[model samples]
Target chain A: MNRLMIELNGLKLEHPVMNASGILGSEPEHVDILVNAGFSGIVTKTFTKNPRNGYPPPIIVELDNGGYLNAVGLANPGINGICPVVERARRHGKPVIVSIGGSSLSEFIEVSIKAEECRATAIELNMSCPHVKGHGLDLGSDPSMVYTLVKEVVSTINTPVFVKLGLCDKIIESAGKALEAGASGVVLINTIRAMAIDVYTGKPVLSNKYGGLSGPPIKPIAIRAVYEVYREYNAPIIGVGGISSWRDVAEFILAGARAVQVGSVFMKNRRIVYEILEGLEKWIEIHGVSSIMDLVGLAHRV
Target chain B: MFKPALKTKTEQLSSTLYLAEFKLVEPVHSKPLPLQFTNIWIPGVDEIPMSIADYEEEKQVLRIIFKVVGEGTRSLRDRSGFFGVKGFLGNGFKTRGHDRILFVAGGSGIAPLPLLTRYCTIDNCIVDVVWGVKSSDMLFNIEKVALNPGSVYYATEDCSYGFCGMVPQVLQYIIEKEGVKWSTIIAVGPKPMLKSICSTIDPSIEVYVSLETMVKCGLGACGSCVLKPLPKLLCIHGPVFKCNEVNEFLESTHD
Candidate 1:
């Protein structure tokens, strides 16, 4: 029984499987469906202080090799709108992690408190969404800003706070600063900034002219990021990006992620959660691993 | 869910519309019912949702008809070799009974009609197809529309060949004159055209409309294709909805 349960910064989950932010976590109904689909935890879509309309049409372009380039621009139904979704997820006994993004520290602090007040088990500070301009990479790349933002939110909220870091050059430094500022965990590697241009038309394919790329293409990068972060601070890590199967979950756990969040693959089939959970259970049984906690950073063992 | 399908042919239906047929590398065990669509990825260009025009189960060939509306479609039209296709997506039209069927298609909306026509004829049901195009030159596959015993009605705005004016006017004339106790009306076209036809047709008759919107994922995950007011996800809930189910959607203003 211990082999399946994962404790993320003291919050215990039935399984390490969680829905990555921004897949189908926006509405209350989506959260209910995701919980019913068997994810141990559910991350609500990134919420801002107010409602955001997001980018115009043509926001997502599916790539070959089971990947996608999307510029959804973080279209979320404000902070207040997420209360019902969080409440619904909690009713199902799934740990509800609220993902919040904002351009200002006050906005982040306000939303984080709202999430905690709404009974969110955790809050994932989305300081790493790459496609959005002021709210994502710009805020994430600066270690000092991340430290201050996480510090303020952590101080105000009782819920465990996790800072989702991007693939920036200063990721290690940023992760360290976030942990020092009181973030209980870190979710590594948001979508990498990418774009696709139409060869015939000689123009960018995405309406935003740029988007974030996710799916199988970004798995290695996510793994490496997790490995590097765990090597240094050994903080509670939730690995995301390009995770599709149970093997990927094992890989992330081996690389130091205590839990894994799945996104793009859910776009292919919502039932993937059951498959991944089933595969993990079988793997633990065959390998005679005592528990999933023992497997964290197992690859780092000499 | 994603497979590399072989493009066997790209036939030009008109200056705007093109029909490209691809033979699935491995045949789908179950045929994607008529009105279901596929997401065709032209590698370097981009991927877009295209309505399945027809499918030959034995040959494992899938036909998709699309207009070169954007850069993606333009690139897709020119491509010749194999491309990745993710499909058998969206719920197809509900043609369950051997009831009298009327297919009202406007412009390139004729894409899915022939397949539905074929499905209905196999059950020996009476199918009346009313296809409206800009002109006679745009008409390419009237014969395919006439497949088996179904009657084909043409309405072109230019009066180049059939009834003059739009699809709804011709449909109104047919509904009043044919007096064929039609049970179902499946209309696919521009939103305004669908609205007009829905308004023109009697409320007692069941109508199914094939809707189009910007689709990123063929699944219901993305909220991109949600039909407003009711906010139904088109990819999963329907690309096909009874006219009454989405009658408000057709009339409402889209963002």
Candidate 2:
């Protein structure tokens, strides 16, 4: 089989498939799927210094098509709670990307440092969680803040820094700013802002009133954002948004993403990652594609 | 305590109810008590917390009754197989070790009350049960509790079947007419029913209520099942608590 290995800063992954933050919890209970599917890495759910209770009920809701609205509120067991899971993934011998978030800059630095102490392969700054009030996506929306945060994080940690970005008004410019601020790469389009109404109650389905929309609905938007950023910057792109099949993975790669992250599809079909990888390998073999790098930005040249 | 061994799905009785039994694959610390729950996980669907309704120690089998409340239970109802279940979760009712015990159950709440009655029979303790539902159609097999004789009472709000009142009302009537002196009262049901029974009774009687909180991990790791005012983990501190410990929040919210 042709190798799907790709380089992200100093880290080399066996394949492009990585679990997005928040979707996969500490145990990455779905690691079996990733391992069998030929995924290169798995990112743990976003962790903070203190344990978080997340949001109240109605945290998840289904949308049209295979899309979903989730406001899991970054409910994590804290940094202490994630250590054992990280060690387990390390024993599995695959790259473990620790997705981390914090309410303040110092908290973020502390989480990153703690993760490094546990021998995490890489750190993905989850400055793109759209559910929580003041953390995540709110932090990524401002260019100055992104720069300051990424610079501080990159300087403090010895590991490679991948800034996970959200879909905002000026994400392309923001992507450039993060790279310049010492980010090794970027994960594009966390989720678009969305909401759903309960027919019976005549109220919003989510307790938070709003959530991040993911699944096939956001794939095109994520691809476009990745293409635009790839066109303007030199940093590698980790394409994420509505990826359920091999074709969706290919679309992101052709649009210039070096790798891809799958989230919502895992909820619908735990085996979707393996299914997509199998299909990708079959297509590659038939098409005589020697490397994944050949697929990056192919659609753009044509 | 009880742990799930083998999970089996019996035929569905109605659109909302599914009857499933799990054998105690391993004996836990204590005997399975009434109103104690377990967390069940159905792959690719959802994971939910459910209550243990009956246990046959001789057969090493534990039974659970559940109503399809959300995506998790809905999926369990759809699938016909032995799904994943983790059991005897949460603190269950502790019989006061007294001679006379009264158990009040409402709606699906009746599921666990029978387990307590079964235990009382084994202990040679006197047991009286008050079971209630909104209507007769919502009722199900009561032979298990009824077979005990002179120990069970049934009530329905619509008066389509037995006594024409709620479970708490029936309990009050039983105390007045039967002249039954209950050394300890255990109530499990809707928040309103449990609250009413607690508030109307004298504190000296020793009342305990099985509270339903939104439990996730069942191991106290999730912290989703915390009861307010008490500021304690329901999955850890209790699924069963004295009325006084949770009275402030339970009474205020339910009323």
Could you report the DockQ of all the candidates, in the order they appear? Answer: 0.18, 0.03
CA-based DockQ, model 1: 0.18
List of chain B TM-scores, one per candidate: 0.94, 0.86
What is candidate 2's lDDT per residue for B184-215, written digit by digit as tens? 88888888888899889766688888888777
lDDT tens string, model 2, A119-227?
A: 8888898888888877887899988999999999899988888999999987998899999998889999898888876442245656677888988988989989999
lDDT string for model 1 (A1-302, tens) is 56789898787888899988987687776776677678889899999999988875456766656788888889888987779889889788788999999998999988988898899989899999888889999998999999989888888878899999899999999999999999999999899999876543355656687899999999999999999999999889999989989999999999999999998888777689999988998888887887888889989989
Per-residue lDDT of B142-231 in model 1, one digit per residue for the tens? 564336536788889999978888988998898888884788888889998888877778876888888987677566666667676554
Top-lDDT structure, candidate number = 1
RMSD of 2: 14.9
lDDT of 1 at B144: 49
* Per-candidate clashes, comma-separated: 0, 5
Worst 10 residues of 1 chain B by lDDT: B141-150
Docking class of 2: incorrect
The A-chain TM-scores of all the candidates are 0.97, 0.94
Clashing pairs in 1: none
List the candidates' TM-scores in order.
0.74, 0.59
